[model samples]
Target: MYSPIINISALEPLYLPHEMPTCHRIRAKKEGAPAEAVKGRRPTDVTIAQNLRPEVNIWREADYPGASDTTRELLHHWFGRDHSITTADGEVIPFRY
Candidate 1:
């Protein structure tokens, strides 16, 4: 369970298109016309993508003394997972960021 630690501290909020829908919904076609497109005067509710700023991990790789390959890999994996936030119900939400 390699949970990702989405460090929002260095991340930037993803902005949506100004023209993106705020709440405009699609309508079903009537008579014999093709599918109607989603159109409205107001914007529709849509979410934009999340992105990290600088988008680079500047951490320097350090060597652990006397650590075995399997043990080191396991520690690295578990350590990463441990940093992820958990819900009160104990459900590990993957990609919840």
Candidate 2:
């Protein structure tokens, strides 16, 4: 299945750390074929519409103090303006903080 896109802006500010490489993990249920058939496929394999659970992990860099502009730039670089990710079955799922 397609991986979910993360919305950094939607995340709780309290959960975000000032340190670099703040790791974020997200999980979603699979929808489509059986898991046995897709067992050996790569995580990003989009060849077949397989029912698979996809997890997305991202590490964000640290932001400078009082640097709203820099933070916005980082956010854009990490997550696009739309903040919606499409799955293998063409399902769009919004990221939850």
Q: TM-score for model 2?
A: 0.22
Off by over 4 Å in 2: 1-63, 66-72, 76-82
**lDDT, model 2, position 73:** 81
Which window of ten consecutive residues has the lowest lDDT sum in model 1?
51-60
Query: CA lDDT, every prediction?
Result: 0.41, 0.44
Model 1, 1-97: lDDT tens per residue? 8875443333332322322233332333554333333443334254222122112122213534467888767756754443355699998755311
Candidate 2 local accuracy as lDDT? 0.44
C-alpha RMSD of candidate 1: 17.8
Candidate that scores best on lDDT: 2
TM-score to native of every candidate shown: 0.22, 0.22
